[model samples]
Target: MKIVIAEKPSVGRELAKVFGATTRKDGYIEGKGYSFTWAFGHLLQLAPPQDYGFIGWRKQHLPMLPQKFKLAVRKIKTKDGFVEDPAVRKQLDTIKKLFDEATEIIVATDAGREGELIFRYIYYYLKCKKPFKRLWISSQTDEAIKDGFRNLKPGTDYDTLFNSAHCRSESDWLVGMNATQALSISAGNRTVLSLGRVQTPTLAMICARFLEIKNFVPQTYYQISILLSKDEQVFKAISTANYKEKEEAEKLFVLVEDVASGFPAGGNITAVEAKPRKEPPPLLHDLSSLQQEANKKKGYTADQTLSILQNLYESKLVSYPRTGSRYIGDDIFAGVPDLIAKFTGHPDFGKQAQFLQTVALNKRSVNAKKVTDHHAILPTGEQAYGLSADKQAVYDMVVGRMIEAFHQECLKELTKITIQSGVTFVANGTVIRSAGWRAVFNDPEDDKKDEDNAALPKIAVGEQLPITEKSLLEKQTKPKPMYNEASLLKALETCGKEIEDEELRYAMKDSGLGTPATRASIIETLITREYITREKRNLVPTNKGLAVYEVVKDKKIAQAELTGQWEKRLEEIRSGSSVKDFKSEITEYTKTITHELLIAGASISGKLEEEKKAEKVEQ
Candidate 1:
């Protein structure tokens, strides 16, 4: 008999149904040469510091670096202390029994790094030696599942992926456990000050920005806008003025509009340039991008979107929810037509579905070279039914994104007209010739430009156009905004550079501060530790968070780029381009950071104590 183990019971049941494993048991399903079992997310995890014989919070254990981390059954919080999770242990026992009886094992966990770690930790903890094959399917469609079984790869082929995943888990544990304990102890705070590979830098970003904003003194700047009119056509032109005083801006506005009739003209409508631009449809939804769009449109937090997407994935309405790539693989391209056809009768797709049938779908998003462990998140083509309102919203996003990915590019004409007053003025406008793929998701708000750009209208070069109104606009130089969940995720993806280079961003994408699968959880960790709180959508640092940030602000420990570099090295290790020098480097870095933290000048707890004493004296 062959035993298959999945990450969760929901996934296990789905696979079991397709495989005809109908006989249900306590912890597994059995029928016809197959036994399907499931784990409750994680059956085993790395043992904590105390489990390694390191007693209570002490200075000697400041930088507790384990030579070889130990794995044990998952633990749960009891009234007295953490105890072994009974449900996990029982399921493990059942899995072990099945492993003992079966000739071979199949790992059917989620198709990503964390998923890989989850199963490997269990197999190692249980000391199971049976040879195993990997079931690597993205969506759990019956056809996809059947195809996966026929082409099962040897388990050893994924050793590099497992290595990367293991390294991630261990590194996060080392940094988070050591840094958190060291900071908490040094500060003498009774409350636990938590930090992690992703959360620490993220918290630092919010606090740093908050400080900058708080300390900033707003300065007024002025610019002049000219209203031009000719032949009943009206257009507005802006004066490029950098005036420290309002009087100077008024003088320039007067000179341009009144003193010299429309100012001395250097040129007027020298050329009218209009070119057709095609904006290809957006690729399918990846988890981060989906979270961002949802946050922007529906005001759902990143964590909320992740939860909703997870539910959608479990319900078999979408593909895997934690993918980084927005591209599908070549193998999955053949399934696209049928999938698109499933939406034909839906109100959202009734008109657009016919367009898909007539035009050849773009295959730019389907590249095997770009696909990692999992393809993009897409609808499973199953009829979505009986979904909660939140789930329905997310489902629509996925379906709409999928339909858009295959549709034709959006065509638009960009017109740039330059006008002359005393100073040169510019205006820009875009005429949409065809909405094309944008028709799939009818979002009118998407047409709005970024805040930096001013709206303009269509006018030919040298064509006399009337300005509707002229005014001197006063604006203040704005400080950076606080990191909302969406913006923070974008910052992480770019390693905090705010880069505009596509290739650089792409190179840095995989090395992002946190894996796509774990970023939402990292934000939650910050909130749980009281390091940060949400004021509406913006993440604001708490006192503890700010204190920690102040201490680490100048250190590599608080820089997202440093972590990105480390991630690059780990990737090199996976590809055999670099030796695994990570352990030694991590050991040395942990020691340095912990020592510095212990002796750092800031005394947050002492300050608190002094404040309390002063308050008592006043009373």
Candidate 2:
């Protein structure tokens, strides 16, 4: 019998149903000469240090770099401690039995780096030598699955992809295991001061921003404010320049441009510059962009958004959720019109969808070259039903974004009115000449100018207008706002852009602190380790986090450039570069960081104690 394996049970059942497989057995479904099985996400993980004879957290086991990594059944936390999950071990045995009995194996796991690793780990752990073909499909819809099976590629074609994933897993283990043990041992073993390659740098960013905001000194500044009228339409304007001293602003504030100052029609329209701009529709929603938008619009955390989108994906309502690309290839773009038509009945987006049918679809998001492991997330044109409120909200976003991406460009007229009052003042306004994509949601503009006038009355240069009011507006310089989920995700995507080393920056331009699939977990990990906390919408570092950041802020492990270097090497490995060289370098760095943390972590013990005591007091 041919055997197929999927990443989850739901997906496995869906695939089996598509193949007319309905005979359910202990751990699989069988029919039509195929047996469909699955792993619950990851069935195995790298064995812990103690499993390798590094018994306890001690200096002697500071850098416990295993000569060869071993995979153990995934574990769970029981009241006693973490142990091999009995169910997972049973599933592994079931899979081993199926692999032994199978004539040919079909790998139906998710199509991405992590998915590749999951299947490879299972296959190698089972010691199965059966040749397999890969079923790579972005969406789990029946048609996509059927097409994917018809064109299964040789498993060897993804050997290098597996190599890249293996390197990543082993490197993470080497770094995370060694660093975590080293720091935990040195800090009096009071509490687990967990650390990882991505988690540390993320924590450092939070701490650094917190300190910056805490130390910022605000300076009070003043600007001249005036109200001008043209044809019975009143608009507000502000001085073009700010003054440090109120006395200087007061001098300009009383220049007698108001009616009270006996200066009617004192405002002269020096220049009225109105320029038209064409704003193309935003690209389709990649995971990162969708998460950011959800955070801003619905106040959903990254993890929450990922979970909801995953549900939508499993239901076959949308495409893959973890994709990094925001562009669809032309092959997929060919069905764009039909997909848009599927949503012509959507309550919120129907009008826009109806209008889109008559126009040439925008080609901004259609680029086969930019499509990576999978295309950007898109609706499968499958009708959705009985969706929960959260799921429905996310589903609507996917549909709405699809409409916006293929709609016409928004034509806007930007007007800047330079008026000569007592001091030079300016009024800015934006008029949407054509709503275009904006009509999909009809949401307010996100990039509204500061002190912008909603609508400016028509006026010509060299025309005089009455000054309605004047005053000296006091303002204080503000520090950068704390990082919220939306801004934080955007920052994580471009973290390497500010690197002083041009080569490293260039290397990391395509990657950031973590992949789209892993970034949500990174934030959740920091919170799990007590390194950060959520204050309403803001992610703030705790005292414990600040303490750890102080110790490792200067270390290479807490630098984005380290991840950059690793990413550059990993991509090379994916392209058939030697993995041995990369592994050797990682081993050396692991030893170095383990030794440094053994010494540097001692400094944070007192601070951790202080925090513990503070927590006790609060309790």
Candidate 3:
């Protein structure tokens, strides 16, 4: 019999249903000469240090770099301790049984690096040699599944991908395991100070921002404000230049431009500049972009957004959720009209969708070259019903973005009115001539300043207007705001953009600290480790997090560019580059970082103690 393995039971059942299979067995479905089985995400993981005979956290085994990694059944923490999950072991045995009896095997896991690792780990752990083919599809719809099966590629075609995944797993293990051990041991081994290739760099970003905000000194500045009127319509204007001294601003403020100053029509319109701008619609929603949007619009955390999107994907309302690209290929773009038509009845975006059917689609988001492992998340044109409020919110974001991406550009007229009195004053306003894609959500523009008028009265450059009021305005320069989920995710995506080294920056142009699939987990890990906490919508570093950051802030492990270098090498490995060179480099670097942390971690011992005492007092 031919056997098929999926990453999850729901998927396996779905695949079976599509192929007319209904015979359900203990852990699999059997029919039509095929046995469909599945694993619960990952049934196995890289074994821990103690499993390699590094019995306890000891200095003698400071850098416990195992010669070879071992795979053990995934474990669960109970009251007793961490132990192999019984359910996982049973499923492994079932898979083994199926593999042993199969003629040909089909791999139906998620199509990505981590997905490849999940299946390869299982196959190697089972020691099965049954040749297999890979089923790669972005959408989980029945038609996509059927098409994927009809064009299954040879498993050997993905050997390079598997190689890249394996190297990443081993590299992370070498760095995360050794560095975690070294630091924890050096710091009295009283508490676990976890670190990783990506986790440390991420924590460093939070702590650094926190310190920057903490040390920021506000500079008090002053400016003169005046209110001008044209055709009985009033608008506020500010001096074009800011004054460093209050006395200078006060002098300008008393220069008599107001009606109370006995000067009627004192303000003369120096210049009125009007320019039209066309804003193209935003690109489609990639996972990162979607998460950021959800955070900004609905106050959802990155992890929460990912969870909601995953549910939507599993329901087949959307395509893959973890994709990094925000562009779709021509093949997928061919169906954009029909997909847009399906949403013509959507309550919130119905009018926008109906409007799109009459115009040529904006192909700004269509580029096959930019499409990566999976196209940007898109609706499968599958009708969705009975979704909860949260699901509905996320689903609407997907559907709304589709309409926006394919709609026309928004047309706006920008007006700047310059006034002459004592010193020059200016007022700005924006008028939307055409809503275009902006009509989809009709949300207010985020970049509009509070000082800007919604609309300005029409006036000529040579016209004079009455100055109704004037005052000396006091303002202090504000520090950068704390990293909220939306801003933080964007920062993470473009972290390498600031690197001084051209090669390093270019290497990381496409890759950031973590992949789209792993970034949510990385944020969750920091919170779980007590390195950061959610303060309202912002992620603030905790005392414990600050303490850890202080120790490793200057280390290579804490640098985001270091991850970029590794990502470049990993990409090279995916393109048939030598893995041995990268592995050797990682081994050496692990030894170096492990030694550095062993010494540097001692400084944080007292800080950790203070945190413990503070926790006790709070409790």
Write the number of the candidate with greater TM-score, choosing between 1 and 3.
3
Question: Each candidate's TM vs. the true structure?
Answer: 0.92, 0.96, 0.96
Clashes of each: 11, 0, 0
Q: Estimate, for each residue in 1-619, the C-alpha lDDT of model 1 and write its tens digit.
A: 8999999998888899998889999999999799999998878888899988888887788799887899988899999898998999899999989999988899999877777788899888889887799998877778788989999989887777788778777888888888878877887756566777677777777788889989999899988776655555555656655678998877776655432354323335545666788887777777888998888878898899999998887777889889888788777889898889888887887679777988899886888777766788989888788998899988888888888889988887777666665566666666678888888877453655432133344455565443456677898888888788888888888777787543456567767887677788888888988878999988888766776787778766788878877777666666654335777787787887788777762466765456557768989
lDDT of 3: 0.89
List lDDT for all candidates, in order. Answer: 0.78, 0.89, 0.89
TM-score computed on alpha carbons, candidate 2: 0.96
Native-referenced Cα lDDT, model 1: 0.78
Error of 1 at 150 (Å): 2.1
Better of 1 and 2 by lDDT: 2
**C-alpha lDDT (0 to 100) for residue 469 of candidate 1:** 60
Model 3 regions more than 4 Å off: 496-509
Decide which is better by TM-score, 1 or 2: 2
Off by over 4 Å in 2: 496-509
